[model samples]
Target chain A: MAAKKRKKSTAAENEIINLTNVCKAYSTGAPALKDVNLRINRGEFVFIVGDSGSGKSTLIKLLLRELTITSGYINVMGYDLSKIKHRKIPKFRRNLGVVFQDFRLLKDRNVYENVAFAQRIIQKSNKEIKRNVPSILSVVGLAGKYKAKPRQLSGGEQQRVALARALVNQPTVLLADEPTGNLDPKNSWEIMKLLEQINENGTTVIVVTHNREIVNAMQKRVVTLKKGVIISDEEKGGYIDED
Target chain B: MRISSFFYTLKQGFRNLFRNKWFTLASIATISACLFLFGLFYAIVTNFAHIVKTAQEGVAVSVFFDDGLEESRMQEIGELILKRPEVSDVRFVSAEEAWESFKAEYLGDYADGFTENPLADSAHYEVYLNDVSMQSALVTYLESLDGVRMVNRSEIVATTLTGVNALIAYVSVGIIIILFAVSVFLISNTVMIGISVRKEEINIMKYIGATDFFVRSPFVIEGILIGLIGASIPLGVIYGMYNVVMDYVTTRFTMLSTLLSFLTVDEVFRVLIPVSLGIGVGIGFLGSVATVRRHLRV
Candidate 1:
């Protein structure tokens, strides 16, 4: 019984975030989440897949403190999500990088400056930006496109620039919301490969996707939500109904 | 972040202002026209007052003694005029001395034609009154005195000067009010446009941990620079026009012997420095606060 308890304690030690009865509802009288419970472990890659309006984005937003929890406890990186101040959101966000489906690159700035903007907000030194941005650009295969503006770049290249900006500060957790939604199959696979490489470097990554092919290929722990309730939490889970 | 980023934003603000040149030109045009009109008004008021003061100084009463009046009687009348509260100074121009001066001045080379100086054989009492308006009462008082032939105080000139001075005071107050309203309207709109254009940038900056003061300072500084620029165009124009008007007044009317009453050339430049700075900095700071209050979240 002592050995069994030690194994259980070790399992608990791997958990980075634990959510208890988390619920999020909109003011317009529709429940977006209903008593949802989730656990994300340290150094784990998580793919949250669901149908439309299944509370995937809401879950990500809740974790980021962009939306407050309606009626549950969410302890992420040691801070209670419901009780966090609006001003303290950035400090929490500093530990995480968020990538959106639309590839929100600052159009007025060139690729370097676009990436530099995030670092500037965090008050990174010029020496650090000089040291890190080049390596980050190289990692995202955007070395030669530093001076190029977002308008001048192709969709794949722009997405890569966005990825570089997200990864520039070396965030511990990467939350990608349909990161390759606008990319071609070839580019999508390339981005997936890059995400896999990043995950391999010990950063916990959570990807929300509607693309079944990429979701199936990732071969990670998948949490499937249906009508704001977790229907399945499976190891090495593929697309929802694959035999 | 370092305070240098604020400087960076200021540089960006100026660059943005210049980049949008059609807007800049429109602003500059309005500013220039306003300054030009303001300068013109100032010059008119200045010259008007100068003319009035000159007329006032020149409107003295000449007390011509009766023909062959005794020197003692003339001295008594001079002493009496001097004793009056309204009189500032009294000088005596004797008939023979006055004739020789008039011969040399007005008669010129034709002085020999007059066998006798047919000018009145009288002592001219040059009377300086304390106020030009008081000259009428003073003339009445002088005429009431014994042995006084005429009291030559120009009532028409005094009345005209009083009317002009009143008009000048009214117009100055009106122009200043209009100019103030125009400047406030212009600077507020300019700052509002700037805030609208940078709405996204401001949002991103705010979210990125920039303090409220950091985000607002650049806009305030920008406003001040813009206002300074707005007022500076007029400052230069006003100074230049001051020189032109000073030279014109000095050349045309030396007898009035008046300096530029509004401002001298050097003083005009000196006054412009503070007035322009005050208008520019004050308007800029105020407009920026108003703009930021409407736009910035904090």
Candidate 2:
């Protein structure tokens, strides 16, 4: 019995994110998410696919603690989001890296400064920043472009810079929300490959995207949301046709 | 709060000030204008009060003894007058000295006609008071004492000086309060604009797990720098202006100096410098804190 209990605890430890029957309702509108049950294990790469106005964005926001769950429980990397204090939110967020659709790079700063920003926020030592930022930039295939500004870079290079920034802090989970929304097909594939490489190196990657081609081609776990409800979740699944 | 982060926040704060140069200039100008008016008022009121104090010190109450009073009894009256808390000093004049002074003033050059002393009963005690407003009370107390025949005081001068002092105090307090409020409002608005301009940057910082202190420190620093510069400029300006005005008043109106003395620039700045800097920094800090609390929820 003791051995079984220990195994159960280990399983719980491996589940990095757990959401049970989560529901979110905004003021003066229908519920954004309804009775959602999702569990993302450690080092898992999952894609959240949905049409516009679906609950995919809502789920991502909920996980980021940007929006409060209306009803249900959310536990991310050992923190109960519902019970977390506002002051602790920043500390909690440090454990997760986030990339936005617009590739939110600091336009005024150079690529190195932009990536170093995250490290600075965490108060990393200057020596650590000097070491880690270049290493991550190199990983994202932008080592030579450290001094380049966001305006001087192509869309792909800018997204790469944003990716380098997100990974520079070595967060446990990388949450990419439509990361390739504005990129061309070749650039999108490049970003997807980088996300894949990041996942293979043992970081959990959750991608929320509407690109059907990439979604179908990658053949990863796909969770589809329709009208604020999870209609389908499949392993080795492609984008389900919305009829 | 590592030393590295501390330096970074300081650097960011200075960078932010330069980033929003126009807004920073506006804030500094607002603070400078407010402090300049404050310093000007302060100099004027302090000088006015100093003049009143000098005049009050000179306006003595005359106390006369009853006729034929014993020498010991007169001495006792002088000691009693000296014991009063309101009395700063007491001097007893002999009848002969009083007669000499009266004759010297009124009978100058024609004095040989009146060899007999007409002012024999004019021996009196001159009681100087610490505050002019307390003159009436001291006079009343002096009148109640034995061996005192009369107590004479300048009632109109005392009342006028006391009224002017009271008016200066009230006006100073009212104006300082109004100016403080105006300065804080102007600084808060400037900080609000800075926040709006950096709204996107702040949001990104928040997402990147920047603590509230980390995010807010730069703006607070910006406000402090603006206040510091604002306060410093006025001190220099006021210093120059005060000297110019003092020189102009003393040289231009030579007769006024004999009656009323102006404070030296050093003396005025000894009080004004710290007070102005404190207000400037305080307004900046309070303005930034209030703006951040209301607008930068992160």
Candidate 3:
């Protein structure tokens, strides 16, 4: 029994996301991220906190390989992003899931279809999509609400649908940008709890937000950015810079 | 790449094309209008070329000889002229035969007044050419012959027919090109709007790791469907309309029908069907590619 109880150590040491001396500057403006360095191990739950213009979005975009970097190396899932050709981007992205501030669910589709959309994109069989979508929906606490549309769901439940969509692929990294930005306090805490649950299941989850209460209560690893610079990286940290 | 994904994108493209019915109809209308003009230009150009060809085919050149030229020498010159590949036939006119015919035509009742066939130097040849453009060259060649004095071909008819044929070809090609550009430009903008309408959906698809082909192919397919419908409408309309005009012209305007012939509807459609469809699909495929290339960053 003890031998059967496995350890995640083997996969955890892979360094799922690494950014060394990274720089990104837009043509119309100054540098968005300046010589930023970060390392995220597999199965780690981390929060990326920053004020506006603090490069949170740019970092997410870079990880998505949506924006071309000015300098430095980024390796995700052992793929050197700077050298990875554009043709390989789609395959690379499958290992990383992303959720936006808005729910971004297909307005025409129901919760079940939305969740299954990710699998459909990866060309999963209909039987697999049918079997997996409901199970994933139950994991997100939407077990019987598969037929419910986005407009029918509350903001928190809608975010849960989006989260279900992102997690259906069982990705290595789940990136959430302001996941609870539109939810109230109760809904925000609910989303935080769901994210915590997802992280506990061995998926490395990164949440970027300006929310203070959830950050303070979560007591997770927090990396704070100020003007595109990493000001603090703390394990078991809180909301603000108390130093 | 898989069958399920193919069906998925196919459905998406169909739904997207018809999501806003008015918008799709407007795009089709614009495409059909352009294709209609293309069809008309094709009909007019082909028929005009045929008419020009027929008119030129009827023209023959008359080569006259000098007075007191030996008949045997003129026959040798005629044989030499006949050896030219361009000359279809050369009918030698003996001086006596010319006098007899001329008297029969002009001196009808007073035929006996010309006591001695007064026509000399009438031993020439009526030269029929396979192609009218060879007339001037043949005439120049005939003038340099030993016994031939003058080569008489109505330069006005030949030059005008050639000039009009070339001008029509240039003008028709120019119009077709302009219409093609206009259709591509208009369809591209319309397709750009369609892409923008579904921009959020595309972003989500990308986030879910849809390849460039997967994301882009639907729009391209959508463009093709639009083009097919657009082309098909004008095809039916123009086919029926051309037949009606052909029937009316053949029945009522016998003079114009005899002189300037129009292609039968079947004949016109033989070329029009494929060409119009090609233009339609070409516009759609190119428009979608251009819009997606410019707008969809990934």
**Residue A203 lDDT, candidate 3, scale 0-100:** 94
> Candidate 1's residue-wise lDDT over B192-220, tens digit each?
67567666666555434454565676666
Rank ordering of all candidates by DockQ, starting from the highest:
2, 3, 1
Task: Order candidates by lDDT, high to low.
Answer: 2, 3, 1
Tell me each candidate's RMSD, in Å, in order.
7.4, 2.3, 4.7
Name the regions of candidate 2 deviating beyond 4 angstroms: A1-7, B114-116, B294-297
Question: Lowest summed lDDT over 10 consecutive residues: which window, candidate 1 chain B?
Answer: B255-264
Per-prediction TM-score to the true structure, in the order listed: 0.66, 0.93, 0.85
DockQ of each: 0.18, 0.74, 0.64
Better of 1 and 3 by lDDT: 3
Task: Sort candidate 1 into its docking category.
Answer: incorrect
Which has the higher DockQ value, candidate number 1 or candidate number 2? Answer: 2
Interface RMSD of 2: 1.3
Clashing pairs in 1: none
Query: Which is superior by DockQ, 2 or 3?
Result: 2
Output the number of the TM-score-best candidate. Answer: 2
Q: Ten residues in a row with the worst lDDT in model 2 chain A?
A: A100-109
Sort candidate 2 into its docking category.
medium
Which candidate gets the maximum DockQ versus the true structure?
Answer: 2
- Candidate 2: tens digits of C-alpha lDDT, residues A14-53: 9999999999999976899999999999999999999998
